[model samples]
Target: MKVLYLGDLVGRSGREAAIKRLPELRERLKADFVVVNGENAAGGFGITPAICDDLFAAGTDVIVTGNHVWDNRDILPHFQRENRLLRPANFPEGAPGRGIGVYDVPGGRRIAVAQVMGRIFMDAMDCPFRAVDKALAAYPLGRTVQFTLVDVHAEATSEKMAMGHHLDGRATMVVGTHTHAPTADHQIFSGGTAYMSDIGMCGDYDSVIGMQKAEPIRRFIHKTPGARFAPADGEATVCGVFVESDDKTGLATRIDPVRVGPRLAETMPEVV
Candidate 1:
């Protein structure tokens, strides 16, 4: 099994990056499944149903989100109907959407995807460690599911690293999002789980993170609110992680970083 996991989509530039390049990416990566984080797709705040549809039409299998998942109130109602979209699993019970989604791949194989939030420097939520433990227990790899990945969206790198180690032998991969900047660590653990501290954002790298550079800079220098934040509309770099899993055991055998655009040098892994 092969999975391509994209980091947070910043906004127009990010969304456009995926819509325009995703099909080619899938072909180049030879990915069998694709998961993208869309929390920041809507003007860098919240994602909408229409945006999700575009990503799906572009060959995305599942969409993951983070702390800003609920920024746009319209998504709450759609959550009940769209199983492909996911919020953090650690969110309180009765939350609008689910975090765990299992979809069929080929040859009767199944790929399970889940998202969880970290509390170290992010919004408070249920214990992500416990939440992920329960989730992995519910679906054992190579038995209950052919492959599985858990997205740990957090700010603290230590928390993400800990989670990666905690679920080392359990999940096929443990990818971190929310930091926007991609980390250099992409390694398959001794237990077969692929790990990356962050996948990086898909948007214009020229700006501050993904937002327009001016406002963030002004606010930082003046210590006062400036204009509302907006997504950087310049050329975007598609960023993500690619992994190839063992056919029978469904454990990751290789992992690599992917980045393609004018801002960052291109990267693609030999896989699947």
Candidate 2:
């Protein structure tokens, strides 16, 4: 099966680019499933219900989030109503939404998607290792679902890589989020699981990780509060990773990175 996991949708430019190109990309790539990280789909902070719906309509099967999951209080209700949206499972027990969901992919195959937050340099949360272990235990492969995708929303690449290695062979893919900078290392693990340190952001590459640079620069230079952040208004590069996995074992056979649009080189991964 062919699966596409996009990085964080930073803001307006990211959303626009994704919505504009995703349908064609899906058709051209013959993707069976698509997952998008929407933690920053809103005005570079949090995603709203409307934005989530838009992504769903645009061909996203599952929406993953990270620390910015609670930026908009209005989204609190949708968290309960929509099982397709996932927050970090490592969050406290009383968090708003679920962290795992199963969707039926093409050919009647079941795909389980889950998110876990890293503790290093991030908000205090339950240990991601234990959280993932619990999720896997609850949804064992080959029985509860045929394919499993884990999104390790985190800050440190070391932590995300650790999670990928830990879950090697158990999951179909383990991809990272939150850094908003696509890394070059994308490959299938020895265990047949697809792994990448970070899938990056689907936003304008001209700005500071998707936000307008003026505010962040001012804040950093003066050490004082300034204007709130907003998404950069520019042509965005839709960034993500593509994975081809075995239908029966739920293991990846190939993994590749994808970059398209302005501010970045055009590159597409073909399954090997």
Screening candidate 1 with a backbone cut-off below 3 angstroms (N, C-alpha, C), the clashing residue pairs are none
Q: lDDT of candidate 1 vs native?
A: 0.91
Candidate 1 weakest ten by summed lDDT: 263-272
**Candidate 1, which segments miss by more than 4 Å at Cα?**
none
| Residue 69 in model 2: lDDT | 94
Task: Report the number of the highest-lDDT candidate.
Answer: 1
lDDT of 1 by residue, 188-235 (tens): 999999999999999999999998889999999999977899889999
lDDT of 2 at 173: 93
**Cα deviation of 12 in candidate 2 (Å)?**
0.8
Superposing every Cα of model 2 onto the true structure, what RMSD results?
1.3
102-172 in candidate 2: lDDT tens per residue?
88876778988999998889889999999998888877776677789999998999999999999998899
Q: Estimated TM-score per prediction?
A: 0.98, 0.97
Candidate 1: RMSD over Cα atoms? Answer: 1.0
